[model samples]
Every structure is written in C-alpha cells, then in structure tokens.
Target: MPPGVPLSPPPPSALANPESLTRRSHRFQPKSIWPVAILAMFVMLAIVGIKAYRSLSQNPAQSEQTVEQEARLPVRVTRAETGLAQKWVFDDGIVWPVKRRVLTFQAEGDIQAIAKINGRDLRAGDVVTKGQVLATIDSRRQRSAIDTANADVEVAVQQRNQAQATVVQAQASLDRAKSDLELAKTELVRYQELFDQGVISESDRDVYLNQVDQAEAALRSAEQDVRSAEDGVRSAEAQITAAQARVTETNVDLEDTQLVAPIDGVVAYINIREGEYWDAQRLNSGSDQDLIESAPIILVNPQDIEVEIEIQADEANEIDPGQLTYVVLEEDVSAAQAAGASNQDLLEIAQDNGSRGTVFSVSPTQTPGSRGTQVSIRGFSSAQNLR
Candidate 1:
C-alpha cells in the first residue's frame, strides 16, 4: 500500500485465478461484463430458428392438398347402346369383284371379228339368257368340217338303202328256195311210189331220184346265198347308224364355235381383236415370229354383288342373316365439327347425323393379323353415291 513503491506483482497462484487477480491487481480491469449481451443474442437466434423450422414442415402438406382439389374437377362423358349383327375389327383387305367368268373358244381358230374391246362401258347388270352369243371365231373352217360330215352322212344313207334292197332280194330268194325244196320232196315220194307199183321203168325211176337230189342241192345253195346277203345288209345298217351319230356330234361342235356368256353379267375384259389367231394348246417359242396366244377372250362379272369377310370361328357364331347393323364412313373432321358449336361437343351433336351405311356379310375364317373377328361393310346406296 505504499504509493511510491510499485505494487508488487500478484502471486502466481492468485494471478491464475482470474476473478481474484482482476480485483486485487493494481492494473485496471473493466468491471462491466459483455457476457450477458452475447447470451441474449444467442437466445434470440434459437427462437427464430425454431419458428422457421415449424413453418417449413407444414408448407408441403398444404401444397399437396391444393393440387388434389384441382385434380377432382368434373369431365363430360357419353353412353350409347347400338344394335349390331356382328361386332367386327378392322383388318387390311383387298377389294374384288363379286362374280367372274371367262369365255373361251370351243375349237382352235383365228378370231374373225371382235364386237367389243376393253375399257368400254357396258350396261350394268343386264341378264344374258341361255344360248346368247358373246363372241365369234372364224367360221370358214368349222363350216367346211360340218359340210364334210354331212357328205359322209349322205353317202352312208345311200349305202344303207342299197343294203336294204339287197336284204329284200335275199328274203325273196329264201322263200322261193323253201318252196322248191318242198316240191322236190313231193316229187321224190311220187317217183318212189310209181317205181314200187311198176308203173315206171328202173332207168326212169333212177333218173327221177337223181333229179330230186339235184333240186335239193339247188335249194340249199339258194338258202346259203340268202343268209350271206342278210349278214351283209346288217353290217351296212350298222355303218349307217355310226355315220349318223358322227353327224350329230359334228353339229354340236359347230354350234359350240361361237362363244357365249354363261350367266348374267357385266363385261369386264375383251382380249381378242379381229383377225387374231387363237390357239389354246400352242406354246411360245421365244422366237421373232409372234404367235397368237389364246386366253379368256372375254371376262365378265355377275349382276349380284357380294362381299366376303374373314372372321374368327368363335365370333362368327354371333352373326345372323337378318340382324341390324351400322357402318361408319371414313372420318370427316370438317363434317363432325360443323354439326356442333364447339370441338368438345362434336361427338354428341354428330350422334344422329352424317352418312349411314350397313353391314353385309361375315366370313367363317380368321383374317390375317386379326385377334378377334372381321366383317364386311356395304353401302346401301349405289357405289357412285357412296363417299
């Protein structure tokens, strides 16, 4: 405590204890502490951190609830019940004519005339009666053959008449021979009776017996000639019959020279031209000389049109002959939209509008690439009118 003497430094043990050293040491130590301000700042920071954590934990649940409410908004829906003969799935298919026929020549010949050609518009669905002529071949050779057959028949008929005359002559000769034989037998008996009664000489009786033998021999010869002549007549008659049969067959072939349509149809193709040679059996040699090849001279389709569709065996059982059906044409977006005021309402407005079609047939076999069934749709209106 002397002012002039420097305050003796505090003891090491007392300096080590900060509270005691700060109070006792002569060097000034600040009494106002800053630890309370630092503690207060730490407390404020902890409170703010707790509040922020609580807000962050609740934000995600509130956002998810808002999203769920938006997702529950209502949408429009429609339902319809339609009668269908058969439900069918679409498949890739080819269009084909309903009926087809080919006209061919009966005999090999050159085409003399062609009444029609390809691409010509023919009357649709006209019925062709039996024996109608559709096309013609060269008739010169066919007529010549027919004439030859006719000449042969005429010759055969003349020969048959001559044979008939021979048969009549043979029959007459047989009758005469039989009468002569009987007369000879009666003469022989009379001569024997006369010789036994001694009314005739021995030489005369022997001569009469010889004469009877000669007459009998003559009658046998005549009968044999008659039999030969009858046989010849029969042979000639058979030849005549065969010749007549040949004439009839030739006539039939001649009639077949002209090709005719077999059924009612529309002409589709005409392959022959006038003066064209048609040989069905001839083959091409690949040489420079061109030979006419014969195929179907004309092609036709029948009046009745039919569509064929392939379907699964299981689905075909539901189809009937007279059930009602509907067909939807190719999608027309413009037409669909025009029927309604808005795009969202188009389907409902078009339910009773647009072109109508129908189902025509169903096939028994499964179509290629189809898992279920296939059906054929046909337009009720004419093909030209259908879109």
Candidate 2:
C-alpha cells in the first residue's frame, strides 16, 4: 500500500450490475397494483353493504315510498281564484294640454308690464286664471285715439244740432212764404173783383199781379233753403256714424293692448318681456311658419292634461274611455329597456316613476293627413306637471 501505487480495476460483479452499485430508483412494481385494486374493491363493498343495511332496516313498502319521494322534485301550488282577463299595451306618446291657446296683441306697442307670481315676474309654467292679465302694452296711444274719436263724435253731434236748428228756421221761413202767397192771392182776388166793379184801375190790378209773382219767388227760395238744411243734417248724421265706428275700433285696440288669459291654465310660454316692443304685424305677416308658437304668450290647461298617442287604427279601436293607462317618461322607458326589464317590470316602473291615466278619447277615424288614429289619455287626477 504505497501512495504512488496504481488504482485497481472494478470487480466483475459490480460491473455486471451498475444499478446495484448506485442508489436504486423507485419504479412502479406489479406487486403494488394488487393492494390498490383490493382497497378499491373493499370501498365498493362497504358502500354496497351500507346501502343493503339501510334498505333491510325499513319495511319494503316504506322503503319504496322513501325512494320515490327522494327521487321526485318539489313544486308550488295555489288555490284557484276567480278574476277577469287582463291585457297590457305599451306605447310612446306626448303629453299635451286639453285646452291650449296662443295669445297675441292686435295693437302694437311697448310692453308696459308682465303678470307676477309669488312676487316674481311672470314666466313660462306660471299658473293663471281666466281673464287674468298676463301682460300689458303701452295703452296711451290707443287711449288717445279713443279720446279723439269721442271728440269727433261730440263735434258731429254739435253739427247735427246746428243743422237741426237750421232745418227748423227753414221750416219757419217756408211757412211764412206759404202765408204770404195765400195773402197775395187773396189780395189779387179782391183787386180783380174791384177792377171788375170799376172801383180799381188796371194799373193797380197789374201791381197786384207783380206782388203775387214776388211772393211765389220767395216761396221757391225758401223751399230750396229747407232742402239745403236737411242735407246738412244727413251729412252730420253720417259724420256721427263714422265717428262712432272709429270709437268702437279704438276700444278694440285698447283691449288688445292687455293680453288676457282665455282659460284657466298654466302659462306655457312667454315671448315678450317688460319694456319690449310688441308688433302685431309679426303675428299676422311674419315669415315664421308657426304663428301659434311665435305668439307673445302661450297658455295650457294642465288640469286637463291629455297624452296624445298615435297608434294603428286597429289598436285605437281596442281603447275606450275609462280604460286604465300608464304614462311612463321617455327616460324611464329607455333606462328600463336598457336594463332588459320585462313588461311587468316596465309596468311597475311606470307605476313608481310615472303618472297614472285613463283613456279619455279614441278617435274613430284616422288623424287628418296621417294614417294613424289618435288616442287621448288624461291623468286620473289633475296633473299640473304634465305639460
């Protein structure tokens, strides 16, 4: 055993079995498979044994019933009740006032005042009563016109009185002319009788003839004067009639200056402000296509809020007065639809978020210029917020 001696060769037995020389690697052995298979068989046998024991412990009929009960599914049931058939219909529509009016002035002037509510100037959505003054224009011009017309009427009356007096004077003159003519005729007869009796000269009878001619001329002149006076009276009467017409016109203009609410309603719109100039011409002759929308004031009776829905003629026929209706807002409908809500859900949403209404009217005929029929539904209660 020296340190420099050569290493010796491996043993033939170790070389023949290299696996035995290193640590042995674990591998599936045929011997282990039988134990796993036996364990699984024992587990199956235990489950079957348990089932057989439980089955034998109960009566045969009771066991069958238990199995059947366990195999069957559960269900719910309710007692029968009587009820009427019901159906639901959904539609979109706009809520409008049953009575709507657009008010404008016939006379143009500067707006002097606007109606107030709760100490604030009148505006859209304000409530008003019938004949309430919604606004007023400067009425001085119309008032002046009325005064002028009245003055003209008074002047015409004066002229008429003066003419009547002239007529009376003319009548007096006519009467006097008649009396003079009679007197002249009587004198001529007397002169003729005297001349025939040779108690009057021919020259004197000729002088009586000249006096009768002069009296006739005076009567003709008086008749002409009476006719002239009567004409003056007729002219004065015509003037009076014309002046009265003017007065009536001015009164109408004055009324036009004040915008009055024609119905009990809410103010839907106000196109004018205090101190703004009002022009009637725009109402009648403006280029705007809708005169009503352009009016100075717009009113709507929201207490009679009616939802106007256009539907197929067939659908309209199914609707009747007093039928229940629900009006859901467009936003609610959209949201509910986006959430994939069912019809019942939509109805519930409408009940919670929208107004309840009743079918007020259903048009028998199609709407004018449209193929759809109009169905009107009014709120069950007065809805001031509908409009």
Candidate 3:
C-alpha cells in the first residue's frame, strides 16, 4: 500500500465480543464514567463521615465514665471465721484525748516572754515536760515587791530587838526599885520597934511609916513599866510574824510570773502573747452561764487518746465490755494508701482504715434527750490534730 493511503477496518474476530466493544466505548467516554464514580465516592464518604461524627460525640462520654469508675473508692468487707455473714451496726463517734488539760494562769499578770526550749521559743504545738517553764510574765514589779517585803522584814527585826532591850532595861529598873523599897521597909520596922519601947518619939515613928508607903508606890510604878515593856515585846513579835508572812506572799507572786507546765503534754493553744495581759476573768470555772474553748494556754496529752462511741440503747446492751469492735471511718483514702490491695478483690480503691478496739465502758444510764447510749472504747488511733 502507498504511504498516503488510509488503512482498512480490522476483521470482526477481535471485535466480535460485545464486552470488548463496550470496553472501547467506555474508554472513549471517560467523562460519563467519572460522574458515576464521583457519585459512588460521595455515597461512601457520607457513610464514613456519619460514622466518624457519631464516634467522636459518643467516645468522650464513655472515656469519662471509665475514668470515674477507676477513681471510685471500693467498699470495705468484714468476714467471720465461719464464712457466714455477720450483722454489724455502724455508729457515729468522736475521737479525743483521754485526759486533756486546760492550761490557765495560776496567777494573773502581763505576759513577758515564752520560755525557750533548746533556744526555740515555746508556742502552740510545742511539747513540754512536767514543771517546765513555758512562759514568763513581767516580773520586774514582782521583784520590787519582794525587795520591799524584805525591807519590811528587816525593819521588823530591828524593832523586835529594840523591844527586847527595853524589856531588859525595864526589868533592871524594877529590881533597883525593889531594893529601895525593902530598905525603906526595914528602917520603918526598926523605928516602930523603938517607938513601942520608948526609945524614939511618936513623930519619928510616923515619918518612918510614911517613907514605907512612898517606897511601895515607887515599886508599883516600876512593875507597871515592866509589864508595859513586855507588852511592847509581844507586839513587836507579832509585827515580825506579819512581816514574814508578807515576804512569803510576795515571793509567791514573783514565782507566779513564770508560767509552768503542770504535766507532760503538747501545747495545744496560746491565747496570749508576750507583753499582753492575761485576763483571768475569761477562765471558765464551775458555771453553766459561760463556756470557754480553752484557758490562756492549753496542754493536750498526746500519749493518751480515746474515742467515745455512741450507739442505739438496745445495741449497746448487745455489746459487752471487752468485746471486740471495729470502727469504720467516714472518710476515704487513695488506693496507694490502702493497707492490702490484694485481699480487697471484692472491692477496689478506697479500703477501710477501721480501727480495732474493745468496749471498756458502758453508760450507767441514758443521757437526757440523747438518742442513744454512750460507750467508751480505750484503744483506737489517736488523732492529735483535732482542728
């Protein structure tokens, strides 16, 4: 064939199949096939988008719920040796110190400075021993008072010495007057004897008698002076005693300036500070009219602490003294703090920190207006920080 001539149509064997014809026609019309492909793609994308939207909206809530479940505390379980369920009753109670001391000013005065322990100033939450000096008041005036009392005592001693000397002098003077009186009496008796025997005149005898009376009067005056002197000595002694008493009292007041801890305890509170006046009137004695949280200072014994349990009156009767009791705390703790996480397969998370104790005391009678009986248990975990 010439190079310019067109080729003739191919034979029918190759194009005999309708499928092959269809394929060729389809290739020629690519735009028509594109629209169908795009529509199918749109349908598939719509399905996928609906599923994805639903998944995004619902997955967060489910994840949040799963996290909450993980953080939730597990319940505590108590078992009996018999593997049988035991009925246990719960109650509300308070844990407190066994014996707490309400520290107060034994003597009223202005606060000076809190006593330092190992150079650390004493304050609330400080541990103290018995008879430890906790604080000091303004004792300058008290020292002055003690000095004045001492001076008073010295003056009294001097006065007493003077009184004793006066008594001795008075006694000496009385002795001399007595000697003169005896002499006068002897002379008067001799004169009377002479008058009776006619040895002397009557006038002479009468003069001698008058001399005896004068001597007796002088003796009486001396005796009275001695009595007065003795009385003065007694008065001086009394003054000395009174002065000594004052001195003792002043010394006591001076000691009062130092606040001492009466027992071994931790200082729970301090309602006063240095240089501040502690008003004793705020202290609560035996009276229903007023109640105080604490005294100017307070002490709590950390070694001894107890929990008071309250339960229904009927239930209290069911529990005997020395019977074991388990107290469940109202609060919860994290799983990390739990005692044994393995045995707690029944429940997960917050296991009970229940304290083990025994019933030691039963109330003699129900408290007035109380809904239950009060019982005391001695052994439990002591919580020092009440606040």
Number of the top TM-score candidate:
2
Q: In order, what lDDT does every prediction score?
A: 0.60, 0.82, 0.73
Arrange candidates by TM-score, descending.
Answer: 2, 3, 1
Mark the 10 consecutive residues where model 3 has the least summed lDDT.
Answer: 343-352
Give one digit per residue, the lDDT tens place, for model 3 in 18-51: 7776667746432334457779999999999999
Give the top-scoring candidate (lDDT): 2
* Candidate 2: regions farther than 4 A off: 1-92, 116-119, 125-129, 138-141, 280-293, 317-370, 378-387
Q: 1-387, model 1: which lDDT tens digit per residue?
A: 445654344357864888886676687754423456667898999999998888677779796997899889987788876642333333333233455565677677776654443544223334454456766777776677778777877777777677778778877877887787788778878888999999998887787678778777877877787777777777777877777787788777776667777665655545566577776654333421222233443344533333345556675677755454333233443555465545334433333443233556666556466554556555433332122
- Report how far residue 268 has shifted in candidate 1, in Å: 2.5
For model 2, the local distance difference test gives 0.82
What's model 3's lDDT at 96? 56
- The CA lDDT at 264 in model 3 is 89
Better structure of 1 and 3 per TM-score: 3
The estimated TM-scores of all candidates read 0.54, 0.62, 0.59
**Candidate 2 positional error at 315, Å:** 3.4
